[model samples]
Target: MPIHIKADMAASVWKVLVEPGDQVAENQQLVILESMKMEIPVVSFSAGVVITVVASEGSSVLEGDVLVTLSDDGETG
Candidate 1:
């Protein structure tokens, strides 16, 4: 299955911790968003191989914006 990880709220992207081809675990932090002077961590809901990183550091994002894409079966091609 392919998973699209999205931002839950409007915020500026503080950091992107994973890139395409990175293997991640469930609950692994993928990106950090800064809103109202607070850092919010975006985590993966399941283990997967990162296929794409849509959010860039210092970029502003809106609620429901995709931050990352993952392939649960470890195949991105």
Candidate 2:
């Protein structure tokens, strides 16, 4: 299975903290978003290897938009 990380709100991507094949822990910051003059860290919901990033730096993403995908890695069923 795969885990999809989505943006919580509409914002411009400030930075991408991880790359494809990078290992990430649960709750790890994946991408940073800038909105309302504040920086928001988009977190990973599962601990696994990042398979893909759907958005890039300086791109605008809306709520519910897929940001990255992670392999399940047996962390959860």
Which candidate number maximizes lDDT?
A: 1
* Model 2 misplaced regions, further than 4 Å: 74-77
Per residue, candidate 1 scores C-alpha lDDT tens digits across 1-77 of: 78999999999999999999999999999999999999999999999999999999999999999999999998985
Whole-model lDDT for model 2 versus the true structure? 0.89
* Per-residue alpha-carbon lDDT of candidate 2 for residues 1-77, written as tens digits (9 for 90 to 100): 88899999999999999988888988999999999999999998778988888979999999999998888774322
Give per-model TM-scores: 0.97, 0.91
lDDT for 23 (candidate 1): 97
Q: Which stretches of candidate 1 lie over 4 Å from their true place?
A: none
Per-candidate Cα lDDT values, in order, are 0.97, 0.89
Candidate 1 colliding pairs: none
